[model samples]
Target: MKIATYNVNGVNARLPVLLRWLELAQPDVVCLQELKARDERFPEQAFHDLGYDAVWNGQKSWNGVAILSRVGEIHETRRGLPADPDRTQSRYIEAAVQGVLIACLYLPNGNPRPGPRFEYKLRWFERLEAHLGTLVSLDAPVVIAGDFNVMPTDIDVYVPDRWRDDALFAPEVRAAYARLLKQGWIDALRELHPGQHIYTFWKYWRRSFERDAGLRIDHLLLNPLAARRLKAAEVDRRPRGWDKTSDHAPVWIELSDKPVRARTRKDASSHR
Candidate 1:
């Protein structure tokens, strides 16, 4: 099965680019962020015409998330984080596609460091960490994919010094990402091509894409069960160069269809 994630920036504005990429990439499952539309305006029919079933959480003129499946029905498991009762933003959406538990998130871009937005970003990371703790224990196949909005390491950005004071490259933000990795989730892209400076996002300013000045803020992380079956991971950069495309490209991973066997009491006893 092939799963992909893209931060579309704005679904309505980038609909044409998104449609074209869907045709070219042909991913079995897709996680989309930054819909920037209200719930009623999601354009679900368009995706359905392309043979995809979608579940999305929408917010007006801002954050949103969605999951699309071509070969299987997408059963929504959760709409937002467990403690998020108010549902202030449409940043997270979870669903089961095929046999994998998929999580799609658009983490806040904490700009203007040492401020309210930055503080909120850190708090958000805390919630994500708490939520992921439960997921890791499940030991079932899971993929947490989205635009993380953090430059995980110095190598993840075009220039470490340039973004030193930026919230995305802040030390605390990188540390939070490291904590997530410690939970046994494999960074699929880094694992597939280590030591390579691969980027999934490029700003429109200063001809960032033209100069290849980009950041690897988008990510696809696989839990242990899914990691074992990871065949390949890549950033489809062609779409980033297309007309009216999102600043972020699509990142995807291919996994084997064979499901991870559930651990039985008998197997547990044998190991003792």
Candidate 2:
């Protein structure tokens, strides 16, 4: 099955672009972030018309998250982190779809470091890390996907030197991200394409996309059971080039019906 994550930026403004991409991608499941709308404004009927059943947690004009699936009924498991620093933000939502626990999140963009906002970001990350630790050892497949808003490594951003002072690439944030991986979740894209320069987001200014100047902040982290089923991971950059589209493109992973053999070559697997 194909599972994808996208930061829509603004659900209402990007509705056209989003619809076009969804039609073309036809993923089995999708996790969306940055809806920038209230719960009542979510366009639930639009998704319903496309055969996608969804559950969303939306904020009026800022953060939000949602899970959409056509493969199975979306059984909501959680809506926010156990210890969310700011309860007001609609940044997280989780659900079970097609037998997989999917966590969709829109981490805070703590810009302008050395400030309270940055502190909030770290606090939020701490809460998320603590909560995810509980799921790492689950027997079932678990997917943690979202716009993490951090460049975990230098390679994830276009210019390491230029972003050193940026909250998304700061040493502390990167360290926090590292600690998250130590909890036994695999960074699907990086794991599959080691050393390759892959990006999921680009700025509207400076012709970032045209210049291929981007960041890989959107991610899909998989638990052990889910990692074993990972067949492929990729970034669909087509949508980023669309008119008035979101800065982020879609990142996706293909999972098999059954776990791949222990010694099987990643590219050669044929899971049941």
Candidate 3:
């Protein structure tokens, strides 16, 4: 099963690029962020025509999230994080697709440190930590995919010193991200290519993509149940180079149909 995440930046403006990628990638499930459109403005039909059923939480001219599934009907679980600092923003949406829980989020960028936006970002992280705490230990597999908006570690940034004062690379923000991983969620990309300088986002300025100056702010995290089935994780960078494309590329992961069973007299075998 292939699951992918992409921050389209502006769904309507990038509809063509998005549709093109969807056709090419053909992911079984997709989590999209930064729709930048209202619920009524979401081009649901565009996705349906591609054999995808989508559920989106949208807000006007700002953050929004959606989950698209082609493998099965999407059973929406929730639309927002519990106790979200600002429920007005459409940042989170969860659904069950093919027996797996998929969480799509577009975390706050929290630019301009030492300000209310930054404070709000931290508060949002607290709520996420509180809510995800209930999910990490679940017996059912869970996949959290989105633009986390934080450079988790120095390696996740193009240059640690260059972004030292940036909100995305703030020490507090990075610490919060680390805390999330401590909950037993595997960083899918890092798990598969720990030493590689992999990046999913790049600035349009200064020919960032052309120079390979980018950041790994986008991520797909898996719970232990799902981690055991992880087969591949990748970032399709071609789309990022396209004209009128989003700064972010799509990140995806392939999972085995079922978890590999443990060695035991009654269950010493792979499930798929």
The per-model lDDT (C-alpha) reads: 0.89, 0.90, 0.90
TM-score of 3: 0.95
Model 1, range 1-272, lDDT digits (tens) per residue? 99999999999999999999999999999999999999999989999999999999999999999999998888899988888654888899998887799999999999989899999888888899889878864646899999999989888999889999999999999999999987767798997899899999999999999999999999998777787688889999999999889999999999987744354343343224
- For TM-score, the strongest prediction is 2
> Which scores better on lDDT, 1 or 3?
3
- lDDT (Cα, 0-100) at 262 in candidate 2: 57
TM-score of 1: 0.94
lDDT of 3 by residue, 1-272 (tens): 89999999999999999999999988999999999999999999999999999999999999999999999999999999896647799999999988899999999999889899999999999998888878876767899999999988888888779999999999999999988887777799998899789999999999999999999999998887888788899999989989999999999999998665333221112121
Worst 10 residues of 3 by lDDT: 263-272
Identify the runs in model 2 with alpha carbons over 4 angstroms from their true place.
261-272
Q: How well does candidate 1 score on lDDT at residue 138?
A: 60
Give the per-residue lDDT digits (tens) of candidate 2, residues 120-154.
89999999999998887776889999999989888
Residue pairs of candidate 2 with colliding backbone atoms: none
Instruction: Give the CA lDDT, 0 to 100, for residue 109 in model 3.
Output: 93
